[model samples]
Target: MFAQVRHQLCPDLAIDLGTHQTRVAVGGRGLILDEPSVVAVDSESRRILGGGAAVGRVAKQMIGRTPDGITAAYPIRGSVVHDFDLCEAMLGSFLRKTGRSKLGLKPRVLMTVPGAISPVERRAVTNAAERAGAGDVFLIEQSRAAAVGAGLPISEPIANWICQIGAGTTDIAVLSLGDIVVRRARRVAGEAFDEAIAAYLRREYSLKVGSRTAERIKHEIGSADPLDEELVVEVSGIDTAGAVPRKAVITSEDVREAIAPVLQIMTEELRATVESCDPELAADLADVGLVLSGGGAQLRRLPEYFERQLGVPVRLVDDPARVVIRGTALCVDHFRQWRPYFESAA
Candidate 1:
C-alpha cells in the first residue's frame, strides 16, 4: 500500500540506456526524454563541462568537433556501462530533466539490458541507477522488451523472433509464453557500420573522416542491397596522405559494399540463433517471421536484406528506435503482471 501511494505521487520511470542514446518514460506517461548518450568533460580535470549540464544532445553535438581540453565521452558502450561515474552523472541529469526529483520521492526505475550482460555489468547498472536517485532498479532483456514493444504475441505458445540492432549492439531472441527461449547478442551494430564506412573511405579515397561524418554518409546513401536507382552524396574529409582537406562524391554502392561484411556477420549470428532453437519453435519463425527494432533497424533496405538472407519475412516496427523504451514503459505501467519477468539487479 505504501508502495502504491509513493508510486502515485511520483510515478516510476523506465529507461533504455543504449550505447548511442538514452530514452526515459514515465509509468503512465509515454516517452518524455530521448537524447544522445554523451557527456562533455574537461580533459585534464575529468569533470563534466557546463557545471555537469553538458550532457545528452549538447554533449553529443561536441563529438569529434570539441576543441582541445574539452572531450566528449560515451559512458556506455555496446549496451554496457563502460565508465561508472560518467554513466551515473548522465543518468542523474536525465532523471532530473523528467521533473520527478521535484516530487521528493525516488522513483523505481526499470532499465533494459543486453541479453548477455555479465553479472558485474548488471550490478554496475543497478548501482549507477541507485546512486542516481532511483529507489529501486530492475533490469529487463532488450530483445524481450523489443518483442513486447513490437506487439508480438509472446504469451502464446508460438515463436516470436526479434532483432534489435542498436548503435553499439544487436540483440536477437526467440520468445514464447512471455519468456525468451533462444538469444544472441553481438557488438557489431550501427557503430560498426560507421567504422566500416570510415575505413572504406580511408582505404579507397585516402580520406580521413570523423565518426559523425561517417554516420551521416551512411544515413544519406548507405544500403544493404542494390537499389533500382543508386544514390550518391558529397563527403568532405582530410586527405590521409597529403594531410590536406578534400571532398569526394561517394555512391550508395560504396556504402553498401563497406557495410556488407558487417551485415553478413550479423546474418550468420541470426542464422545460428534460429538453428539453435527447437524444431517446432524454429518452424514457427517461418510463419510469424522476424521483427526488427532499434536505431539500426532504420537502415535502408535492412528488412529486405534480412528477408532475402534469412528466408523469413522481416517486419520493422513503427518508431523502431523507441521500441525498447516503449516496452519498458509498458512493464512499468503493469508492474504486477510483468514483475515476474523483471530481474532485480539489486
Candidate 2:
C-alpha cells in the first residue's frame, strides 16, 4: 500500500551516469537534468563543497582552477563508480536539484551500466544510488538501453545494432528478441581522444595541454575523416621546455592523426563483435545497419567514417547524448513490463 501511494506521488527515476556527463529522467516526464559528472570537494576533509552540492557544471568549471584546499574531479570513470562517496554526493545533489527528494519516500531509480563492468562494480553503482536517496534501484545494460532509446525494434525478431561511444567507455551491442545477441565494451573513448590530442600537442608543438582544452580543440577542429578544406583552430597551452604559455594553430587532420590509435582499437573491437554474432544476425546487420549514440557519437563525420570503413550503414540517433537516459526513462514508465529486461538494482 505504501509503495503504491509513494509511486503515485513520486515517479520512478532513470539515470545515465557517464564518465564525462550525467543525465537524469523521471517517469512520465522527459529529461530533467544533464550536466558534467564532476564534483568539487575540500581536498583535506574530502567533503563536497557548496554545502555538499557542488556537482555537475559548477564543479566541472572548478577543474584545473581549484585552490589548494579544494579539488574538482570526476567521481565516475569508464561508466563505473571510482569514488563511491563522491558519486553518492554528486547524485544526491542532482536529485535535490531536480526536486527528487521526498520527505521519507526515496524515488526508485533505474540506472544504465556499461556492458563490461564486473559484478562488484555494478554493486558500487547500486550502492551509490541508494546512498543518494534512491529506493529499489534497478540496473539496465547500457547498449540495451541505447537500443531502446533509439527506438529500435529490439522486441521484433530482426537484429538491431547499437554503438554508444561514451566518455570513458564505448558499448556496442546487437539486439534481437529483446535481448543482447552480441556486445562489446572498450575503455578507450572520448577521454582517450582528448589524451591523444594533448599528447600530439606535446609531441609536435612542445605544448602541454589539459583535458578540457583538448576537448575544446576536438570540438572545434577534430574529425573522423578529412574535411573538404582542412579546418584549423588556435589553441593555447604551456610550452613544455619554457613552462610559459603559448598558442598554436592545429588542424582537424592533426587531431585525426593523433587519435588514430584509439579509433582503430574501437573499430577493430566493433568488427570483432559483429563477427562473433550468430551468422544470421550478422547478416541481418546488413539490413539493420548500426545506430550511433552517446557523447562520442558527436564526433564530426563519424557516421560516414564508420560506413566507409566497415561497409555497413551507420547513422546517429536523435539526441544521441541522452539515448541511455531516455531508455532508462522508458523503463521507468513501463516498469512492470520492462522489469524483466534488466537486472534488479538491489
Candidate 3:
C-alpha cells in the first residue's frame, strides 16, 4: 500500500539537524517544518502525539511550557541523533505534513551533519530518516550547508570560509572546490552562550536562572564586549537560596564578561583553522574574509572579535537563524548537481 509507493518514489527533503532545532525543507517549499529538536512522549502509553500536534513551531512552544503527563526531549544532540527512535518519530511528523501539501510524495532527504561526526555517526542520521519514512537520504556537512546558504561559491576554486555557530556546536571550515580543506567542530555555541550567561549571573548577581532565561538575556542584551555606552535590562529570576523570586537590572557589561571565555575560544578556533588552511586557500580567504552564519553569529561584537583575532574581515550574514536550513533547501533542490559536494554516503 503506502509502503510500496514510499519505497519506489518520494520527494526530496533537506534537514538541518541542529542542536537547538531541526529544520525540514521539502523540495524547498519554503521550510515545511521548523521545530525545536524536542519530542514529547506519553511514557505510560508509549505512544507519540498526533502528527498534527507533534511538529514545527507548535512543538517549540511546548518546550519548557508543556504540562504533566507529556514528557519532552531532544532526540538530537551536538548535531547528531542521540535517540534515533524518537528522532524518526519527529521526522515522521514533518513528512506527513509535507505529504499532505504535496499530495503523497515521500521525500529523499539531504540532511546537514556536523563535520565532526564519524562515519558511524553519519550512518545513524541516514538510518533515522529511513525509519522515519524517507525513501533515501544524503548527508551534507553543516559548514557546507552554511556556505551555500551564505552564497559562497563552493563549486568554484576560490576558498570560502564559513563558521556556523549553532546551539550545540560550532563548525569552522575552509571550503574550496566544494570540499572542506580545514575544519573544526566544537560543542560551544548557542547553548554555551546561554551557559556563560547563567554562570555570569550566578557569579556576579547571585541570581539563579534556567538555560531558557539565560538565552533570553543573551538575545536581549548579551554582547562579546561592552558597548560604547553599556545598556541595561531588567531580569526576573529566583535567588540562589530556596528559589526566592528576585529582580535585577543586569547590564550588558555583565553579559560580556560572562561570555568572554566562550568568545575567546570561538575566535581562537577560527584563528587555528585559518592557520591550518593550505596556503592557496589561506590567500583566498584574505579576499573573502570570514562569513559568519548561524544563531551564534547574532551575538553583538562577534564580528569585531573575529576580525581582531584572525586579522581578517568578518561579517555576519543577512539571516543568521535560518542560514543552515536555507542552505540545506538549496542543496536538496539541486541534489543532482550538488550531491557530489556532500560527504561519502554510508
lDDT of 1 by residue, 131-202 (tens): 998988999999988888988889999999999999999999999888899999999899999999999999
Better-scoring candidate (TM-score), 2 or 3 = 2
Question: Once model 3 is optimally superposed onto the true structure by TM-score, how far is the C-alpha of residue 159 displaced, in angstroms?
Answer: 1.7
True-structure lDDT of candidate 2? 0.88
Which numbered prediction scores highest in lDDT against the true structure?
1
Q: Compared with the true structure, what per-residue lDDT tens digits does model 3 show for residues 84-156?
A: 8888788777667666424455466788888788888888888888777776677888898899898998878
Off by over 4 Å in 2: 1-4, 61-68, 100-103
For model 2, how does the per-residue alpha-carbon lDDT over 1-346 read when each residue is reduced to its tens digit? 9877777777788999989889999888879999989888888888888887678988866755766788877899988999998899899889888684556778888999999988899889999998888888889999998998899999999999999999998999999998898889988888899999999999999999988899999998889988898899999999999999999999888999998888889889889878898889899998779899998889999998899879999999988888899888988898898988888634
Worst 10 residues of 3 by lDDT: 46-55
Model 2: how far is 275 from its true place, Å?
1.1
Residue 316: error of model 2 in Å? Answer: 0.8
lDDT of 1: 0.92
* Number of the predicted model whose TM-score against the real structure is largest: 1
As a TM-score, model 1 comes out at 0.97
Model 3 sits at a Cα RMSD from the real structure of: 3.4
RMSD after Cα superposition, model 1 = 1.4
Better of 1 and 2 by TM-score: 1
Ranking by TM-score: 1, 2, 3
Q: Roughly what TM-score does model 2 have, to 2 decimal places?
A: 0.95
lDDT (CA) per prediction: 0.92, 0.88, 0.81
